[model samples]
Target: MARGAASERDGSLSDGVRPGEEPADAAPPALAIEGLSKRFGDGAASVLAVDDVGLTVERGSIVGLLGPNGAGKTTLIKCTLGIVLPDSGSVRVFGADVTDGRRAAYANVDAMLEGARNDYWRLTVRENLRYFATIAGVDPDSVRGRHDRLLDRLELTAKADTPVRELSRGMKQKVSLASVLAGGAELVFLDEPTLGLDVESSRTLRRELRRLAREEGLTIVLSSHDMDVVEDVCDRVVMMANGRIVADDTVAALRSGAGDVVRVVSADVDDAVVATLRERFDVRGVETDLGAVERDGDRRDGGDRRGPTAVEVAAGGDALYDLMDALRAAGVTVEGIETVRPELEDVFVDLTGVEPGEGGSDEGGSGEGDLSDAAADSRGRSP
Candidate 1:
């Protein structure tokens, strides 16, 4: 079994249910949102940020929330956190309803939204954790052991005393993650946690989050534009587009649904061979290497450089064999050839009609919309 395979027993404490009142074997889902819809503004200017969204997250599982910009990803998160009151919907954390602004259910929940925006810039790394811990009603002394372990796992122990203002962006991000975990929250929501992080820092954080979910039985909901993070860490992916969920499935299942992509590269390819190749397969694009460009001397004066060193095409399984035969018959220098299996990005593009980060304008951008107005919303509320 995987390290973080979800346990059948629920790990959260539901305030609405008393001990022995409910069935001992049945555990409520970590999160349940039904008929959730939210719109920004009104009249003709109104933008439907979320449209009748329904989702359920199992206990002790890692779920990825993915979407292109202005796809209501942020709005959905706000609605789930009680930051933005939904026009119509029901939100239940564990078993306690939070649909109406009752945030007491959030006692077992914590969020790391807007990257390190929640961290106090002037406070030391340790101080930031302590502050949030206290505010979350966690006893610092009781959690001291768990807190130290979190620091070591996240590699923030060395800079425990360093002021947040002086740390690198990656380090500050880790501090923010530690703060969320320090409170011993059963469920954590992370929005773009790896947005600005370097490769190494991002890798470390993913590992830590997975460990928390596996060993500590923590339920995590992670939202990010970084496909690699979602593919590597999440057990299931819920993809949103045009303010609605278009697909919900595991990463492998989604990838399996895309067409097989084949990449062919050759230095000896010429215009006739290229044309023949395109005719044989559903050509996506051809990329010219410097050598290929040099071969086409007529293109030296910035004319049409038709021949290329590499070509990517989509082909059926049997057609793929014919493509190979056609290339060899044309005496093309087949330097490299392989089937490029679909990745999470391919699935995302196929479902959303646009690539991640390429957003459709309804509402929300870098500096506009409710997401940009972080000040208007508190930890769980977005104005």
Candidate 2:
């Protein structure tokens, strides 16, 4: 309630959801940030880590924050949690200024932030949970009632007596997460939560996340570079570049919305004709997945006369007709053409104006940044 008191009052803020659709008597937003900007250093030496970014998470939803490395995601999260102060911007949790850093806000929001620290290496897993519960102000009797439940769910019950130093890296990560929830939080932030996890542990966490979101109505903010995890877990995603939101929508919409991959399958045809057809097209990308002897099992004698080739095309836009005409003029025969939806990776690549695996922040970030040195120091050890 301290910094974001005016966010709701602005009346111009965008929720993306249609009007009158907000839940009746809904519990206040789990988190909100407006006109958020953060910078590091000063003058020419300064860099903007977050730039006028604003977003709101409704009462219960799984939201994903994604971007290339150094895209300001970590900075935004740190500021929102009041671990670091934004040079200019306001943060609110449940309609209260998060800047106040109230005990309620801290209790209501538990994050397995980047570089999340685990329990003391000398203590057992159970001991670690108890220690964190005490720090979060949880009553011993209350924690005792639910202790076994969480341990079992995380598959840590067997290691309850094992010292933290002896636990596997993934097990410790799970424990760090469990400790955050032991105090009871309505909203949770998981930054690269599955980074060090194996296939099975990752699956377990995914199931747990879905359960919490659907059954417990917990609002979750997840940040990760794992495309599969984000695609499967988030209800919606917000992508950032150069500290600004470049795209915000559902995974399905983003994928199908980008474009289609069209594949054309044809029978025996001339080599020169197919070459002419391909040369005339302005496709985004094209590839030939032809088999050893082509689809008709006709082996090319390595001569100039080539058989028909399937032209798999992408970017269903202009210049298609030109290719068709060229092929016809060159005496090429067409068999069939098909189209398929793009994948989530394709959508992200298109929206961010970057190719897969080569994406970078639209703009460099680094001015007036917030986040405590301690938290950041801890995040360095997350993976």
For lDDT, the strongest prediction is: 1
Tell me, by TM-score, which candidate is best.
1
In candidate 1, which residue pairs clash?
A: 83-380, 83-381, 83-382
lDDT tens per residue, model 1, 269-338: 6678779877767787677753443333343332354444678878768978888888889997676677
How would you encode candidate 2's per-residue C-alpha lDDT over 156-175 as one tens digit per residue?
Answer: 89998999889888988888
Instruction: Please provide TM-scores, in order, for all candidate models, with all chains considered together.
Output: 0.80, 0.78
RMSD over all Cα atoms, model 1: 7.0
Off by over 4 Å in 1: 1-24, 265-281, 289-308, 321-336, 360-369, 372-377, 380-383
Give me the overall lDDT of model 2.
0.67
Pairing residues by index, what is the TM-score of model 1?
A: 0.80
